[model samples]
Target: MTIAIAPIDPVGRAFFAGVVSGIDLRKPPTAAEVAAVHDGMDEFGVLVFHDQDIDDEQQLAFSRALGPLETATGDIAAPHERRVSMDLNDISNLDKNNKVVARDDRRRLFGLGNQLWHSDSSFKPVPAKYSILSARTIPPTGGNTEFADMRAAYDALDEATRREVHDLVCVHSQIFSRGILGFTDFTEEERAKWAPVRQRLVRRHPRTGRLSLYLSSHAGGIEGWPVPEARAFLRDLTEHATQRRFVYAHVWRPHDLVMWDNRVTMHRARRYDHTAVRDMRRTTLTNEVSSLDQAP
Candidate 1:
């Protein structure tokens, strides 16, 4: 199918591609070529490609052109593969997995917020810069991904709200969120390893310094506010940020490549028939880990 590129939404300034077929992502992209992709991505926040029938090496080349891939770690990261693959299909049983549940598994359901509205990894001290996903095997129906334009959301926010959030700090706790999901059993060692998570409500882009939304479902609450009040506040802000009118829906097809700026957008996974296989390979760009009380 011919590659048809389009904006992320009717009102979204960013753009995304809709693939009738797919694109070849195996071969290495030249510097000039990749520059064009980055240029569009900076303006649009997301750029979708179709029909990526490439091998692991080709995928690595394309991803490296964007940024260095984050280290492959945890259950979601692919140890054997050249790049990482985030597998939402298999939730971690950290006990048998013999890993620290203090962070990974507890934050598991937090990813469920992807079904809601959020900036990717916004709760981190140094939030994620970008994300790349390639459709390895997509289910016949459903599991469509939707992305919201946060830059637009930021622009859309009332001036008063923006000023209020300008200096606010919110604590982002994976363990706290895990506790909400009912995983309260933690050894002292685990607790010690995890301090309370927190991040600034607003972040400046490392390069352009353009402001972007900086909060997530993993965000337990705004720092130092009543629990109920913080929850209400965060919920309302996210709700307004991702109204249906500001979204771009992508129906996955095999060999599709989608890239988005983590700093400027929020995305969610739509419900799909779990009985069917919907596999995808993802690489999160290594970014400075964001933290408030924690260290990078």
Candidate 2:
């Protein structure tokens, strides 16, 4: 079956967002269709595929068409045992009772960190290249996920700022970010598990050859700057890049699959009611190496 691509927002501003339709997820895409999706990925950093109606098995089959999937790790609980594949990261707030956890629940508090803008797996040695999140259930209002076009954010940077950051590197760590949100009581083992990784401040898209700002909440500090100064700079850059003009907030529908190029975008989950159930599964595609420059 043929696939269709339509821009979700203005081409000049939100160039990296689009809607893809007319393809069956129950079966894998043809070679031409795969290429079309890749082209769409390179051109538009995020593609929304609606009404996919795919289960974890179908989702894995489709994700394999794009690249190798990242294996899930950690002590996270599995809510939808049968429907949610073991390989997929469960991003839901529901407990075994199929109800949202208490407001002070550890899982609920931990997830609050997602409200900060970040790319998937930025803290890992080998970060994720792309992330596909499928909506199994959603609330009636709020909980919209917002994405920033980092390429556009980079282009909007003044010449002096661009020159200053062109050769810089930022040390990123989940510990640093989570600590900022008062989740600092992590064990020594957890701290070691999330040790800092250095990443280039600017990323050049391997396919499109376009440059994008790779800012993230995981940013600990600039490589050679003082703690206060580095944090100030990082905060300023994040504020600049996440301006409203560079963002698109997606209101999800059940069965919607939203795939995003983590290399060129930052996303954050908006706040929703603490008592409402919200279930989502994410499959992350791993890069060949820890750094984008060494990505396959």
Candidate 3:
């Protein structure tokens, strides 16, 4: 099948939303096809490939074509071999037995962090560039993922607000975000592994030269600013940027592979029944090694 990319109208507005079809994700894409995929991602920021039923091996093969993959942090009870996959992260709510977790399970509570709008691994020193999530199992309703185009959001800001953030530096931490939801009891080891990192409030896409507001729920505070003022500013910016006009909400189907550029987008999971099952596996590409170095 010839691969093709088509735009999607998100409730009458499309902001970097596209649907990719006709490619067999089980096989590695040709050079031309890979170039086309990059072009779509660079322009759309979010691309959905429907009905691609690829396993972990095939998914890793295609993900490697984009860049070096991020390994799992071994923060869960999965075995050593699973953690060492080096290109996969299990984002599921299922246990080893493939059963839904009890509502009180610690893992489920920790996973609640996904409900907050954030860029993948924004607290990391190198940070994530792009992330791909494949839907294996989903509930009958809800659990949709929504993305906000920070590039457009930045453009929508008033001149004074834009100027204020252009040169500011903000600190990001996984601890801060989780704490906000009363999940404040991270083990000392976890805390040690994820100390805060500072990043610019505004980012420039190295290839497109477009500016995007680099906001995330992980943001702790602005450097050298009063803590309360910093929090207020960050909250205001988040509310302003995530308004309906800048968002694209994706409704999932079986065998769907959804990819988003983490640099220019923020995404979060919508609510669903805790008794039902939702299984998603993800592979992330980091700026430490990116496709942009070789993009056409």
Q: After aligning candidate 1 to the native by TM-score, how far in Å is the CA of 212 from where it should be? A: 2.3
Model 3 TM-score?
A: 0.93
Model 1 is weakest, by summed lDDT over 10 consecutive residues, at: 87-96
As for candidate 3, its clashing pairs are none
Q: Which stretches of candidate 2 lie over 4 Å from their true place?
A: 11-14, 74-86, 292-296
Please list the C-alpha lDDT of all candidates, in the order they appear. 0.62, 0.83, 0.84
- Measured over all alpha carbons after superposition, the RMSD of each candidate to the real structure, in angstroms, is 5.9, 2.4, 3.1
Q: Would you give me the overall lDDT of model 1?
A: 0.62
Per-residue accuracy of model 1 over 27-145 as CA lDDT, tens digit each: 66666566766666666777877777765556667888877666433222224421233322222212334332343433434434446555455544455667777787776788888
Q: Model 2 TM-score?
A: 0.93
Q: Give the TM-scores of the predictions, in the order they appear.
A: 0.76, 0.93, 0.93
Could you tell me the lDDT of residue 63 within candidate 1?
82
State candidate 1's TM-score. 0.76
